[model samples]
Target: MEFSQKIDVNILRRTTFSPRVKNARIHVICGPMFSGKTTSLIKAVKSHQKDGKKVFVFKPKLDNRYADEAVVSHDKNEVQAYAVEKSVEILDYYLNADVVAVDEVQFFDDRIIDVIEKIANDGKSVVVSGLDMDYLGRPFGSIPQLLTIADEVTKLNSVCTFCSGRARFSHRISEDNGIVVLGEKDKYVPLCRSCYNELKDK
Candidate 1:
């Protein structure tokens, strides 16, 4: 008998590892750079604050899109936040908060996974938002790991430059050939994969 066909069905047991389904305590919001992820993150924090929960906001020190001490959305809405280069720093800043909110998570190193995991293990609601893909359509950074562990994942959308379709990637057109090029709207455009490739060919 083949191994596949010879199994004792009644005694066999199967186990699956589902991080989100098993412990859906973390929340993640991800999209392209201009997708309003920060806005959504802020709103969730605000709602928690209104409910009288202790809330804290954090961002990578490298992402100073607006102000050093605030998390700014594409629409320019700002919220007070703590800036840290490592995820462990966030633990020091918001140890007592009931909800921990993180922005620009893609800018952080992969070690952030440990920080986020530790915070979530404390039974606090963790909300993180960042670009899922870099300007070149590759995985950005630590955001993907967070997505897998998060209980809820909100994939946001940005208005595409070439059409009304939702934007899923950030196209980078730079005179300099480098992966870490960072700039405002001039260096990037919100586009779907189709539009992005079309524009990329030009």
Candidate 2:
């Protein structure tokens, strides 16, 4: 379903930020809506917890679709998390965390790149999940930049709602042109390239 959803967190279980390269790691899980990004993130966090490592999970304050104070997957799986307005705020909250995971990361500003990098550089593992492209099929926010520096990257696909083919895009059904319209089945549909292309220009 996803690439390495069972990331080994044991490599990051030591103290000390020295020689951070071996200890620090960044993993990214990205895809269109309904592709299970958040579900994968929840699994990754659980893996870290299973290893007895301290973890902190965060969601962009803009994402309140399923819940305001937790990261909830499309299937209703959830984990307690803090909602932060600024990416830098993630730093303040990860006081003793050995691993940090963020969902709906594309909603945050470019500062997220620096924040994620800083966390990893300090020897804490980081995993981020978000939409890789916007409604127009353009790279959304800082995801491209985040992907460039990730230690591991997994791009997932979903069943196209229209044709049941592999879906790698989110087709916006709403009339709003605003970039950040937080919504679910009412406003967006998972789509394959052909299905998306047919509707993109309409």
Candidate 3:
């Protein structure tokens, strides 16, 4: 009667899926509008280029403020890039590239978080630049999560349009009430805490 419960422990063995781990490098540059986030990303990727590493630059298809397939800065600096609608599209072109750079990353879906993590886990350096917060001063899209997981984070600042002080927020000029409206100096302005609170409260 005591031997009735005897069973093989080997039957409980289960295969587990584990992604290969490497010294993945993820660098995120984020800030309010006019903060030179894109410019800093361009500089980082260019440095990688100087080191003889193959680079692939990409941007979300929604952003076309300057060029349809490029990352442009407020000062008119630009870099050619691939425009993709989905985060999964990046895998199609990044396999052979040593450095994968993404601009305007906040415009992409949450899938982007996994895509960049996978890219870096594959031993390629991943650099992303985007708005850390939306016009409403909330954490934007996947950028906040990316900032948390990144190996390095750069938070830049611009002068406030209201007080000429260090601006930490991107204020929306139009009352569109939409979270993803794309515009330049005409639709958005950088603001410091005082000005942002003052304007936002009103």
Question: Which pairs of residues clash in candidate 2, taking residues 3 or more apart in a chain or in different chains?
Answer: none
Model 1 lDDT on a 0 to 1 scale: 0.83
Index of the highest-TM-score prediction: 2
- Which of the numbered candidates is closest to the native, going by highest lDDT? 2
List the global CA lDDT of all models: 0.83, 0.92, 0.90
Candidate 1, residues 81-105: lDDT per residue as tens digits? 9989887788787778888899878
C-alpha RMSD of candidate 2:
10.2
Model 2 misplaced regions, further than 4 Å: 1-21
- Name the candidate, 2 or 3, with the larger TM-score value: 2
TM-score of each: 0.84, 0.88, 0.87
Clashing pairs in 1: none
The number of clashing residue pairs in each candidate reads 0, 0, 0
Superposed model 1: Cα runs more than 4 Å off = 1-24
User: Which structure is stronger by TM-score: 1 or 3?
Assistant: 3
Error of 3 at 109 (Å): 0.7
lDDT of 3 by residue, 1-202 (tens): 3566766666656655565545558999999999999889999988989999899999999888788877887777777799999999999999989889999899998999999988998989899999989998999999878988999999999999989999999999987888989887889999999999999856
Compared with the true structure, what per-residue lDDT tens digits does model 2 show for residues 12-100?
77644568346678999999998999999999999999999888999989888877899999889999999999999998988689999
Quote the lDDT for 45 in model 3: 84
